[model samples]
Target: MSSSSSHPDLILTNARITSMSSSPLPSNSDAIAVTHGRVSSIGPTSAIATLAGPSTKRIDARGRSVVPGLVDAHNHGVKACLARLYACSFTFSASPQDIEAALEGFFERNSGVECVMGGRYGSEFFKTYAGQLLPTPREWLDARSRGRAVYLREESGHNGWANSRALELVGITRESVDPKGGRIGRTDAGELTGVLIEDADVQARLRWPDWTAAQYEDAVREYVKVANGFGIVGSTDADANEGILKALSEVDREGGLSLHVVAAQTTPYGHREEPLDYGLHERWRELYTSDHVDASFVKIYLDGVARDDSRTAFLLEQYLPDPRFPESHRSHAHVPAETLARDYVELDRRGFTVKTHCCGDGSVRATLDAIQAAREANPARSEIELLRHEVAHCMLVSASDIPRFRRLNAVAELSPYLWSGESCVSHRRACLGSERVERWYPVKELLDAGTELAAGSDWPAAVASVNPWPGLASLVTRTDTSDPSSAPIGLDQAVSIEDALRIFTVQGARAIKRGKDTGSIEVGKSADFVVLDRDVMEVDPRMVGATKVDVTVFEGRIVYEREGAN
Candidate 1:
């Protein structure tokens, strides 16, 4: 054990370190010394003792796994903030009635509630709503609200459930036509189903309620507090819209935000010309670089998911169950890819970075296309910083496109939480077939191909278990639903525990184009790291995901320390 010295800068001693700069396995006995928010030394515990000074602050690992603080890589900062305002218990809901009752009860107990928020009702739980596959209707919530607007988002965050009054306020009704790449679920007689799914639907609703900057700031503060408690040192925001960016600026001004914010703005469909004035990218940079915010880049969704064909996921060959819809043949190359490729080229030219939401084959193709175009457009810039460009979810990437990802130095942001019940269905079987399904989430293949990858919570957009452990476990075990114990899906495709941890840490930094700044415990790097309760390497792979955070250190600051840790 390294004795505490009179050092005040920052020293972490007696630690089992997992420096992603090296192999994923924990280094036997490493000590990390950080000063001025940068790692000053990382080596044997004995060596670090030499760097200790009278004013240095020391943190003894007490023999725990020490790795870079987990980076979300891809997520929605605003939603993370807003989600805390509504009923949020999702891991417990077993039935639709149970969910409705719980929500209704929450409403009843918390009278004078201003608005109903949150967007995590799984498909299995919503099946019985109104005795059909639909969203929780506005009618259901009308009784609970005394004109208080109740707004609930669907699991995707792309959709939502609003009260009748809320609907009337938005002026949405049965005759509403579906927006491009979005759906408004309807009843048998074509009546408004109250469920909005995808970009278009949400855009339609956005036209209705305009949130105030003060309210949004409050939401962001609440979210940041929760994150700090859970040991999250930073998050790579996927949706940094103008309004949300402004609110963050306010938080930064007040010095209320403590976590590192990698702000990535989304380019809404309707407002396409890339925002000539104060665009998401420009504003984020201006605000982030000024203080607490970290404007790393932007977010663009090329397509939808594997299950939903109506949106944008590229169809590989043909529609699985339905033969009439032509296979998007997206992986090979197409639109968003073509458009994105062009856009990326311009962005790269402008010294901007990016992370695109590419779920299906088509989406991935579009993302890759954008990267290629960007590189070609500016050939002279030689070493175009890969900028940690990421393909959000390579759910069904074509075999041919895998190599391109590596060549471009782009990252694949894997979301194993997709293993949840919502993803397991007859459609998956009928559309992808068991064999195809088995190959999904190709973690090993991408690793073998030499593609840098990162992990993300996609929080508020995904499940309740956003903690990196569940994600780490899911990546290693390839299990979410369908009894992973009996047999894991794509077992061969899964990576080792160490690799998974890296994907969530150092690799995540790379994805956000911040590899040079945070990510590892090396000297000159930010003191952003987490202390685990147990040695993650010695634990069983299955148990890894269930691990807890003992302490989270961000920029030499102890943001979260487990209750037991003194």
Candidate 2:
């Protein structure tokens, strides 16, 4: 390696560097040297002082906070987590009348749109509109479309409401068949309720419309810029459809993206098959053929949200306290244990990393079983290091199975920020009593069990704040958004600030098998880190979320630096 004086790249000094390397919980150093985008050296200010030459671009951290760049093990990059920024949003606020008024204005702005796409909804906020008790559905959508066609998805992508005209465009009617894995909401009179769930005509629409790779590349650039502004350096582009691989590749070839993404190849099920569709198993193998442009991994959703009564998540016992009512409702299995095992074996055998979205104890257990079978079929180097897979939204895990995760070396890609507050409150409060809610988010439990844990926003679906500190705060405080007055989600299971930070950084990298690469500050590791405005640990644990990232780095390059701060 060339000496810093002769071939200086950059050197960050005076930082209270918190390296998550094997050194210790906290590092014994205050400065770090960066050359050729990897850490060149790290030691006390006096020790590595000789490495910084006059040619090096030095920065005075002035005791500012520095931590590993965040690596979100789970997130959706199919579109900007919030699909369309400029799209006319009819209802964004949390009230019915407010949504109606917003829709009125939206109609006026986007005069030519034939349908109101999804994103106009506050689930429980409803008022009578055209004989429908949908809060986000307003008369303006009906009036503007003039019965032409309008399809709008609920805020929760799980459900959608389409106007009569839009429904007609897709041949949807009361007489139309209900496809497998989807539901059409109806009234007692047997009239279609305009609400659709689980599945959609979206698959049909995608097949019908074909956009050039050029168009998609532009959208992706803006998407990354927007997310970077919010301090996201890494994320799992969960379950991207078949052709998306090519589209993302086009963008990469043109040098258009600044973000480091892992575009998860969609595990196409009965969802849809294309003309050139080589099918799920084959498509997966092709997707990862070249880990070009930094894209990585494959994503699969084993079940739906735990809050949905009809979601079919596998649960240990059906009679667990219902978060919607005092009595527990019978839980059902959506995907069988054997089937999941088969899929994992096929996917793992093909050399693709798998990340499954599982909630409730039953789903998690079933997933574990599948993973176990895969290991048995093809013995891994080590159970814990074998797959490096993760289970997302592990809302409720059985105590007995917690240790199994550590034994297997799997990670729990969790989202307390989603399950912690209001969304947790409005839907789950009534079903699960305070006692059950007390242990709702079991972060501490998983840590105790030796299972590695990572953090996620599950954006658009959960609508939780996107900042990592807020995620860390939620993990420790156990407080929900609606009632900040209450303690954090699982205070009993809460982790220290340092540990929570690990979940977002080094530990997160470990979840994806990137521990030796970018998670921590090491001599040969990429220069990826975040400069915080406030000291995370010293600040009130509750105020951790308020800590803003002043600068962000990825791949030994300075990707983001705040405007005014040093």
Local distance difference test, each candidate: 0.68, 0.64
Tens digit of per-residue lDDT, candidate 1, span 1-566: 35454343788888888777763333444788776667766777787877888777778887878877877766675666565654434432435555556666766777766655544665434544556433346555566556776666655555666667666667677777776556676676776656666654666556655567777888788867677665676677777776777777788788777677777765654324332222546656766553657665777666665554333456565545455345443222224334556678767766677777766666677678778777667777655354657788777778899899888877888877666554443335556668767888788999999999987777766566456677777788887632445357778998888788778777877666667777777767788888888777888777776677888888887778788765
TM-score of each: 0.86, 0.86
Q: Report the lDDT tens digits of candidate 2 across residue range 1-566.
A: 55525443677777887777776533468877787878877777666666766777766788898888887666654454334543445443445455556556666777775555545465553432444443224233455455546666555556666666666666777786676766675666666666676655344344223444554565567656655555566666666654556666666666655555667676653332221122554654455333323334667666655453333444576544545433445454445666667767766766556787776677788778877887777775554446666777787788888888887667788876674445545455444446555666588889988788888877556553455566677777766533457645456887887888888878877765667777787788878887888888788877776777787776656677788977
Task: Single out the weakest 10-residue window by summed lDDT for candidate 2.
Answer: 269-278
Clash numbers, per candidate: 21, 15
